[model samples]
Target chain A: MSSSLAQQKADKVYRDFGLELEISNRTFFNDGIYSGQKNNYLSASIQPEYYLEWSGGEQSFKAVGFFRWDQHDNRRTHFDVRELYWQRVKGATEVSVGVKKVFWGKTESVHLVDIINQTDAVESFDGEQKLGEFMVHFSQFTKIGTFDVFVMPYFRKRVFPGREGRLRPGSEDGLVIDSRDFSFESNAEEWRPSLAFRWSHYVGVLDFGLSYFNGVGREPVINDLSTFNALYGTIQQAGLDAQLTTGAALWKVEAIYRQNEFQDILALAAGIEYTFGNVKNTGIDIGLLAEYLYDDRDNIALSGLQSDVFTGVRLAFNDTQDTQLLLGGIFDVERTTQLYFIEAERRIGSSFSGAVEARFFENVDPSEFTYVLRQDSFLQFSLTKYF
Target chain B: MKVLTITFVLLSAVVTFGAAQTPEEKGLNVAVKATKADEGFVSSVVDLKMILRNRQGQESERFLQNKTYELTEDGDKSMVVFNSPKDVKGTATLTYTHKIGSDDQWLYLPSIKRVKRISSSNKSGPFMGSEFAYEDLSSDEVEKYKYKYLQEISLNGDKVDIVEQYPVDPKSGYKKRIAHYNKDKGYRLEKVEFFDRKGEKLKTLTYSGYKQYLDKHWRADKFFMVNHQTGKETELFFNNYTFKTGLSEDDFNQNSLIRASR
Candidate 1:
């Protein structure tokens, strides 16, 4: 045994821990807010994570806890255990069982292939944050690729902010619907079974994934359309995502096919990002991205990305502060609706950073998912500190 | 008798040419010999602390761990994982340095949950707002520079060889760089002075307290850089170097970048 490595291996406490706290305050861009809540409200969150690795390197455990308190919306005030899992790796195979979050696909604007974890929509409309799921997974790595199989025994439903939340955008008649009123196709509710299989590989400059999942739909279908009450249905989905790099540009594509008792649908997102490094020979680098989103359901889709084009630009300062800016817009080609968004962040010092996000909607069609929230355009600012 | 005279003149000419080597040839010979002393190390792992000083003399510190997998040909792959400065902790940068062309770089942001490919053309830009530019920490290779021997001199009571070199890449911000190596210490690198594109002195880098490992490789324990233009400085302290721990190519690929950050 190498003496230096052996000495390091003697320490059984290969562990790490961290805590993060964030607060966000938002204000509306329009004075015609229908919810009757105060223009500005406060939302705060605390997250703590812990990790441990055995000296033998055969087993490891990780846990992350999250809690949030909101002044405006009761539903927005919640708690979640994002991860608490034990994983073991032996030879070319690995297995893990616990509450965990698994992310898949390679698209920026939409994630059609990621279905294992429930979306924490209240955290951010982007669906980047997810609530962990209880599951048992087995993965094998081979010369050709990695194959993973997951069986999730418990399911978590999606979250929406309270009635007083800015994005709540009350129904057509400004009626606030409580989440408790929603019904499920199966009385089992959280005990529904979910199965997923994914195969991912890299060949030269191309990276790709093929995945299939069968489970209760992540989004609820509106039943008794006038009441805004919904029912959760079961469905099966198959997806393919790929990306290729050539020079300073990356080409990406994501496609999915889903089926349920009511209908079968197809969705796709394709885009390209080209980087122009150091504009004017300066420290800033910019990337131009454009993508088209299409869904067979047209305006009936909930996410509202159907038959629309998304264009965005990302700027990176490459400074010690790690400053960045991203601005994007989704424009409907068949209608006169558009959604514009911008996010900027920069480090205040070594341990603290600040961010601002603004979202706007114009000429939203009533048939679109976000139409009710048309007048909810608002700006948000947050500060995050790590220790 | 005619053939003998012709042979004699040819032999004399060959001897004269061999004695007077061109400056370029001599520089290349020195670099080759210096690089040859560090062969067969395979791979190495290290942890380092970087100290940044601004013009006003204020200072800050950052800690990082790094692993390098050296390929037999082409370039070496290296990944650096940040450990301190809570906001940037868990951030990582992966680089594939090629001797013949610009390097490929990727930055993994824990907040964004994505690995972004960054521009390598701005290598002259300051590294994390420090005196050391991105190009300064480049993986040293013989083919990356064109060298010319300046002279042999005595400095700091030691015999040293001075050489001037220009970067092979056109996007390089420096017009040229001058390096000094101690002749008595097996051509060990000791110092370097950088000149900007306008041919003005920009920065000076010094290394000392080298510790040898694996019986053949030498690594400096302390490295410092001073920016002449901005009166800024940065210091690097290297510790716990381990060589040949069986790191493979698979560990240096894009897929491993996520693992490296954790």
Candidate 2:
């Protein structure tokens, strides 16, 4: 009995510490219309994590620290504790406390329902990067579905690019955003209490989630373009995200109804993806994607995807390197503006990987918000090493 | 005189039973016995390493951790967590293999902390660029196939039973599979040959290094699969298997997937 117990203890191995380093270089094809904008830029980021688990893996603590250095944008170069939390799981109940990031959407074209954490705008153009929010979360799993409840004590303000940043509103006629000059509709400001709930489950071929949030909005309302004045307001939002998986096709939809002090909005994004597997015995899979986005706010909406159509194609090489590529474009229905992009990535060796991305903006109308970025088409390359 | 009479009676009974059973019934009986040989293992966790080789002899390796929860009536629930090949590290996939219709699969991407429901229709495609298909690694339920017994033969000096299995699901990549079961042992699987949808020989998988766990379950520690048409190969090694680790249905859910991935 003693020998077997010792053998069991010897077989368990733990990976407690991890680190990742990423370096990127970007070049713009045409010089930006704004002054102080550089044609070339370099940036680097490091993320270190420490994780520990005990009680038969039912309880754990994790901490992740992130730091970035940018060559041009001072505001973009910053540090954050992406995730610092303690989690416990017992039976069908799970609880987590401290700062964490939560995602809640199904559509790929536009995330209309994912509003938990504030966007880290300077990190990437896709708005997928998020700043962690401090919260106490509880989850209960039942036969009907999974219920998630979140109590956020403090709100995270959205991080934007600095004056020297390429993607920000340009200084066409001395117009630049003063990110410091921001206000909240609530008296508590950044310390305002927030609450959110979500129920997600799968039934047969359909998977869906229904969520509601009452808190400070993740997206700030830009009051004036001249000074780029912004306001964070308390809002109530009800959202639904669903997906239907049928054969080689996936149908997705995300809709939300939100009420705020400024406006009441209804937005929807629906899309479908179909894949042709192993085309002609070449071991390559190609998927076609198309989505339609609509918002009642129309052109004034902060998201440029309003009243637009997005189309894309994805290719999976199914090779040993795990190579993949995506080519996509977003076309504005009311205006002549069009945005095109291509992204490709492949594993280099055991621990390193590389990616390439390029974006183009064409036929931008002056009335549109993205007019300042007309000459900001750029290509970027990034290498990441994981340890 | 009494012992000789009893032996004669037992021989006649055995011959009569063999003559009464049809090839299909015998085949199903053997398949059921092989599956039952590894039953009663409530839950298990094992580490797996997959090595992929191309026609040019270039090789790449992937490491993963797999956990399984055995359900009494329904199909098993399993999760595969990627640990190495750094880019895909912290990614995991959860699968619920049903006895009928289609299986449900979900993928958790750690980079974004998102859980996505993936279509299981592409059963024929390679898994992680390996020779094994998604269907090949799915839970083996008797309802998924129809079996017919072939002639018994000696394989490497061991008596073996060969059975032809026809897939029930139309989306399955294979039309039929020929499985070799060792008769001298506890009806353990020794090898299998897969035929593609076009009725062409596609791949061959061989298993070895059988070890009994919990005294009742048989598991193979090594698996080697070779694709005939593509000239590609994949080898899998399973290590440090622990059974009955007190895993329940909760461990196989999407919530657990996200937690385990982190």
Candidate 3:
């Protein structure tokens, strides 16, 4: 036996742990249209993770915890168990049980087929953050493809930003939705069981996933606009996400069809990203991205990305610090609404990294959902230290 | 006398032309011998420490673990999991190299628990901001390149044979590479010089501290690469290499990337 393996056998212990601390601040260019709204906000977050593996790497346990303290907006200051699961791998099949997060999507502009976990909207505006869902997961790998089955016993409600927050969903009268008054169409409410099945495979240059989900819908439906009453409807959704990689270009598409209480909704987000490596021999790579987003509900769509175009430019410095920048804009197809954003980040030192992000809302029409936040353009800065 | 001279000349010409091997055949023979000498290592796990230095001599370090699985039919499969530069900790990349086609690669971002299919055409781009490109780190299958034997010379007091290779991939950034193989060390690779697309010297890589494992295969524990055009350098230190670790194709797939531990 190798010395390292011999030493590992003697010790019989394998573990990994890390801690991260982040401090962030955001400043608005204009005051909020609502009353008693702050122009600036500061927040801090702490995240720690622990992992242990044994039995020849067949069985393992992992736990990741997150806590955030915001200077304003108590709804944004919360804690969550991002991942706490025990997994076992035996031959071609694997099983896991506990709270975990799963992400599924292929587009850059918007995510239409990603489900399973509730979005943590109060934490970030990008919709990438999610709360863990309790489930029993089974995965099998075969010659043709990989199959995954999930049985979630409980549902986690999607949270929204507070009234004083910048990006909350608002009405024409500047009234924010009160999630406290939310209702569920299912008799079991939050205790409703959710089931999902997905088959993913790669053939040649194309990688694709087809999935079906049944249970409570992730998006809240507004039954009464005046009272801002939100309802969670039990629905069924079928999703398809695929990407074709050809040379320096990647073509991606995500489509979803949902049968909800009010009606059936069809949505899609398709895009292409082409990268030019080592442009002009400067060791910098530049990528051009463009996408189209469509929703059948149009103006009444909850997410408000209906019939839009997204274009972006990504720059990778290819330096030791791993510096990167992305500039993007989303344009409404039939309206004057437009959103422009820029994000830049780089490593500070051995363990620290910093990022700057800014979003601009311009020429928003009253009919569009983003009109309420026309003056909510803001810039944010954040620094994180990892251990 | 004139007829005898003509016969002698004709005989010598036929003997030389029929018996001697061309430079291409000699190069292929060397490559085949080297490949044969290092076969039968089914799998391995190793730790790598990368040190990157700039023109100003500032240094940054990164640590990672690598697992490799060899396939008899196709090229090898490798998985790399980052352990340090903690912000990107637990991020992993999986690659399946093929002998004739473009390689398949996937990147797993631990923060989002997402696996993304990446374009392999970016093989010329620097890996982890190091001097080594993605193509440099991929499994070097003999079929990927066309080789020609150059000459034999003395390097570091040992006899060495120089071979020139031309990449078969159309998207390759390098025009050619000159590799030096140590003749006395089981035909192991010793040094390489890269030429850019414009046929200019781009970088030089030197391997040292070679140690034999399994009583047959030789592995270099250190590699230093210096970029001539950019005045940047990178050093890789390999440690704790163990062979036949029982890794399979399952350990080099997308699922493995997601579950890869630090």
DockQ winner: 3
lDDT of 3 by residue, A1-387 (tens): 578875664456579888999999999999887765689999999999999988767888999999999888788988999999999987678899999989898998887788989888888777889998899999998888889999998988888777777777665566777666688999999899999999999998999999999998888876655556778889899999999999999999999999987878999999899999988777799999999999887656556577899999999998889999999999999888899999999999999999999999999877766776788899999999999
Interface RMSD of 1: 3.3
**Model 2, span B90-198: residue lDDT tens:** 8999999898878899999998889999988888788998999888898898888999999799988889999999999887888899999998777888999999989
Q: Which of the predicted structures, 1 or 3, would earn the higher lDDT when compared with the native?
A: 3
Question: What is each candidate's DockQ, to 2 decimals?
Answer: 0.30, 0.50, 0.60
Instruction: Assess the local accuracy of residue A140 in candidate 1 as a C-alpha lDDT between 0 and 100.
Output: 77
Of candidate 3 chain A, the 10-residue stretch with the lowest lDDT total is A5-14
Q: Tell me the lDDT of candidate 2.
A: 0.88
Clashing pairs in 3: none
Task: Give me the iRMSD of candidate 3, please.
Answer: 1.7
Ranking by DockQ: 3, 2, 1
Docking class of 1: acceptable
Clashing pairs in 1: none
Q: Fraction of reference contacts reproduced per prediction?
A: 0.26, 0.73, 0.75
- Predicted chain A of model 3: TM-score relative to the true chain A? 0.95
Weakest ten-residue segment in model 1 chain A by summed lDDT: A30-39
